[model samples]
Target: MTEALRLPAEKIHAAELEALKADDKERRPPGWALSPRAAVTYLMGGKAANGMPISAKYVGDKRLIETAVATLATDRALLLLGVPGTAKSWVSEHLAAAVSGDSTMVIQCTAGTDENQVRYGWNYAQLLAHGPSRQALVPTPLFRAMEAGKLCRLEELTRMGSDVQDTLITVLSEKMMPIPELNESVYAVRGFNVIATANNRDKGVNELSSALKRRFNVVVLPLPDDMEQEIAIVTKRVGEMAQSLDLPAPKNVSEEVARVVAIFRELRGGATMDGKITLKTPSGTLSTAEAIAVMIGGLSQAAFFNGGKLSAEGLAPNMIGAIVKDPVQDKVVLEEYLETVLKKRPDYADYYHMLSDLT
Candidate 1:
């Protein structure tokens, strides 16, 4: 239980996945971790009949998780599109682990990624010295997953060059990749599939050719819609992190969590909760996930430096550190918000004073 945000998928709950398998009355393709329905449960959270705990990984919408799971269950591939911090890659990791038992099958799509990364690359020395053979072929994770009938994740899919991304078109629709140099082609097994995530902010972004899009059933993840849900996401994540890291337990904290989420939701939506105040928002995406991280960081600091009592003095500086992404305008915006919304709140004035002192 390191503090690192990304955990290897195999380290995820094995019992939960097993419960999913037992709950899976549906037919399964060979070598899958669970049936599609069970995969959805593990993603969205549900109980095992045996009373084992299945943690909720995705907190936004049950339907979206279902769509992604169903897409993979069918012959079609799955694509998750959203802004940063929306848990696109997290869901991808959990889904691959729950469905295929191997979350290591992955490719991090980037501007410089080439066909060698998505397909196969040659061992140049072996190619020149030993002639073309198995020893000269280095398979991409996708290629390995294809042969093994497992799920492969492509992160930041649109970030890759379109040509590099296009290699996936044949890999998905045709379920095969050709190696002319080797006079051979690799065809995927029955349960093989892809789970990809792309940034919606990156839309109009190197647009995935429609041909490529056709290969996937697209699921657009959304930011948490209301303040309470956002708070819940932040609170839950912070609590989990505290326990895993052995940080002194956070208390008197939900109020701060609520305030952080409320501020983020109001600013991101350009309006107040009662729809009374219309405020200007900055360019940074104030997502619930970020709020959770900020709280966890602040709490950890308080635990080590102070007496582990989560105080306004401990958290406000960190919140300011997280929100004021742009130095000039964002600073002004945050200052104004503090003066108007948080200045007069009865129990939260201490946080206001702390924030004023910091920023």
Candidate 2:
């Protein structure tokens, strides 16, 4: 059988979950796959009781993950708020996988999403034939999750219309979905809850209602604390992504990864690493996630076009594409950054020249 292009978190990290489960001795909340402490270990990475190493899924603060897990153990839902590419969705997937043993229960909220998508819908044929009987009901991810006592994820929650988004208020507040037509309701079983993510930097997002906000325990996922931390994240993610893509490892991968991360960090912070130079921040997020994409794109470029040799020439175009979201304004930002900062560094001479030639 052909391999799947991408596996859910539970399948991708099945071994770690199994190892954690084998060693978990803590008291488990009803319907949870792993205990609260064990779930945290699976996320933050640690050695199990039998000494099996569990790889860290999220590289940020342990406290945040702990808080998220603790919230799920209660009646409140978890809302992971962060700027674009802060791993909001990534963390949500892993958390749901660890807590519920399945990450497929997800609703990708968008501007077009409606009540039918969130709460439930009807099988038209069955409804027409059977006159709104139980068999005519079409369960959505949220509805199914409630029925099975599993965690359901809502991605990009703010993208949905305020009215459609409000549909969640009742389900979240009462832990039940009412079907007035059938005079029935679906009450949440133990261990059922929601994990939602929203991009704080996005424009035109519908703000969450105060009533809806009260139903969740919001946790903000912040960007990497420093250059070293950001570089590590980019490097690790790039390596994993490259392997998945079946691309050959490029030469001096670490050096190239560091260069990409430094450029993003400088542009994002609006200053040089040494604090000696002030710079203009671009309209784009220039997030760590984009840095990972840049490196992966560079690796693919080297593997296919440059005979598996990573160079500033291979990385420059991808870097420009990531940083220059707004064609006219961001171009000026990049040019100034190249000349003022990258040009001054003797080590970045190749990057400055390549980027200048491309832009």
Pick by lDDT: which candidate is best? 2
Worst 10 residues of 2 by lDDT: 248-257
Reference-based lDDT, each prediction = 0.84, 0.92
Candidate 1 deviation (Cα RMSD)? 2.3
Q: Quote the lDDT for 71 in model 1.
A: 84
- Candidate 1 lowest-lDDT run of ten: 1-10
Indicate the residue-level lDDT of 120 in model 1.
96
Residues 174-279, model 2: lDDT tens digits: 9999999999899999989999999889888999999899999999999998888888888888888889999988659999888888888889999898889999
The number of the candidate with the highest TM-score is 2
Residues 1-359, model 1: lDDT tens digits:
65766567657587788776776778776768787777877888888767787899889889888888878888899999888889998899998988888899999988888999999999999999998887899999999999999999999999888888888988998889898888999999878999999987754457889999988899998998767788888888888888888886756678778877776787788877888777888667877778888788778878888887787777777778777888899888888877887786777688788888878
What lDDT would candidate 1 get against the real structure? 0.84
Error of 2 at 51 (Å): 2.0
Off by over 4 Å in 1: 1-7, 202-204
